[model samples]
Target: MGKMAAAVGSAATLAAEPGEDAFRKLFRFYRQSRPGTADLGGVIDFSAAHTARGAGPGAPKVVRSQLSVCSVSESDALRAGLQPVSTWRAYGLEGYPGFIFIPNPFLPGYQWHWVKQCLKFYPQKPNVCNLDKHMAREENQDVWEQSKALLRCKEVTKRRPRSLLEKLRWVTLGYHYNWDSKKYSADHYTPFPSDLAFLSEQVAAACGFQGFQAEAGILNYYRLDSTLGIHVDRSELDLSKPLLSFSFGQSAIFLLGGLRRDEAPTAMFMHSGDIMVMSGSSRLLNHAVPRVLPSAQEGNLPLCLGTPLPAALPRDTVVEPCSVEDQQLCASYLKTARVNMTVRQVVATDQDFPVEAAEESERDITKEGICHLEDKITHGKRVRLDPDS
Candidate 1:
């Protein structure tokens, strides 16, 4: 047989030019360090993730084609310090069914800064980069930076000071569920990050969500001790759409079992910057993450993607780039953990997300709760869970 086609091949050399103004406005939000209103002006913002639908991301000047957005040449990824794990059947119906993993598309420095911004996005703040709540904060702990001084001095602290990303038992985003009430609370709904908005659109194009629109985001932060039980993603009004998942900072052994828990699950590796899309059959499968492996840390991941890094953030632009020290620090931190951000369209349109339900203050306690779980699929015969979990 001919060489297997890579899911993210270098055939197309299109660059991602979402524009300076877009970045400026966006990073400005980061610079200011204040939480703005979570209520977006219109569905247009929500439609940022959609492909071939409405317009595309950063298209105020010219309409960008889907191919252009999704096409990140191998050279670009490599130059950006990343590599695509290739496979002929890595994606598509004829290939390995419905799941695809494209490793490290963004350059390490770029990705590092982007992730930092995402972690500090205020609205998602505190909980976004949470610390172990069960353990009380030590008066002498440096929450932002892990200290080696304590170990050097033999002044052992009661517990290791870890970021939320380091020791989170579990964390959820987008819509918060009232477990006692078994209903989603409107009070808890917040707009997904705009920086990630375009990314959803780009990945949607690659995954064939021709009309992808981001309605929700669920972030699963894990340490080595963590495990995600089997579940599905069916809370959205439309099942036809796709859910885009991104893995960062560590590797995990993901099990793709058949339709039920009774059957055994096949194992797969999920590393940093790997993208998983759930469309078609793989969208519905029984999957679980039983264990996490330490990631082969690559914050300065050296590849030759051929894309040039921005020399500077632009004048008056003035947002801080990740210092070499910062990237090194982050790389060290991510060496043994993982953060999974899964974005899905809860409803195709604003109208589809029931207005009445959002307005309702409380859920009916007498009714059985809608507990949807599960995520993208992999190689297997199976029934999956909802995107909510």
Candidate 2:
């Protein structure tokens, strides 16, 4: 389809954990659909997005079933209900990169669990980092030295673009998406965490990417001035699946552009707790964050994320001190920083996506993974850098 078609009704099933199985039968919800029963009184949709899927020759059929509508009440206002789809405003020039969204999945109380999971599983420092095989650099000793110094600094700040040592601070979950080599390979990988995999599926399901398995993730740490160089992600064997992204702490100026680096990217603000989905034609477009905005910009949104979250340390038997330390480090640092967690599918189907070609190709051009997804984000030429002193 040239433009992504919006499905009228949403479908979802909620199942509690095994410990709560006994209560499932007692409170079964038998939601039924009847025509012309949409309640418009309690809700307001002021978005520029036209009423999707109206009736005509090629019009969509009226579905009086379960529906979720997330429209902008104002440039900064947000409204969310039971649905777990994307709700923040979207911007794009051509309709080629289709954006389908749902209501905000971010909840103030419980949704913090996702943030906690990120700190628990991912590493902020490169020494113990399991991603990208930074340990394999036979000659780049600077990567190790710069990374060590980057972690030692307690205050959050982005260094000049002349050096990309800050990127070495991120952690990758799932399949360990590799940027230097440009593909996912078993030769270097970290098994995708089960909790994060399930979370990715939940976020994807609401946005029409059902059965989506999260094969890769790049948990990017953005200091107040950090800027991700523009890039594209074609490493994944499958582009059909939607990419899931979550923003925590400070906001960011996300850029979405055409297929090449020459295309001037459109900028948008991504608030913490906000979710972004990129599917259909938009899957392979060029995108990047030129800078991490200060927390002062929280006035426009983040009404749900009231007052900064306090430092939390969740216990895990396997990785106790590690998880706790990460939590404390992130919690203290995030007071002036942001953490962008993006999930993407790497290998398409069960087929062998041999990384033989990706490793040999010397092409330094930037490609993308998906919406707001920084899969294998590298410092490409598009980004403006400060001249070295």
Q: Cα-based RMSD of the predictions, in order? A: 16.7, 16.4
Q: Which of the numbered candidates is closest to the native, going by highest TM-score? A: 1
Give candidate 1 misplaced runs (Cα > 4 Å).
Answer: 1-96, 122-159, 163-173, 177-184, 295-320, 359-389
Q: After superposition, how far is residue 10 of candidate 2 from its true place, in Å?
A: 41
Q: Which digits, one per residue and each the tens of the lDDT, describe model 1 over residues 1-389?
A: 01112111111111122333222222222222211222111112211234123222222221232223345444333333333312211222122255554545554345565445434342233232123223434521343444322222322234644444343333345564344343354555666655565567656655455567776676665554455655566555666777788776666655444454443333345656666677667676666665555433332222221222355643432134666544544455554456677877766554455675576536532232233222222333222212233
**Residue 95, candidate 2: alpha-carbon lDDT:** 46
User: Across residues 1-389, which tens digit of lDDT does each residue of candidate 2 receive?
Assistant: 21112111111111222343211211121112111232111111212244233221222222212212232222112122112333333322234445443324443433344555554435533212323333443333344334433444655333523123344346566554544455554544567776667656665654556578887787776655455655565667787877777777766656555665444333345666666677778777766665555554432224444433334423321112224444444444455567777788866666665767445333321231222222223444222221000
Error of 1 at 253 (Å): 1.0
lDDT of 2: 0.46
Q: Each model's TM-score, in the order given?
A: 0.57, 0.56
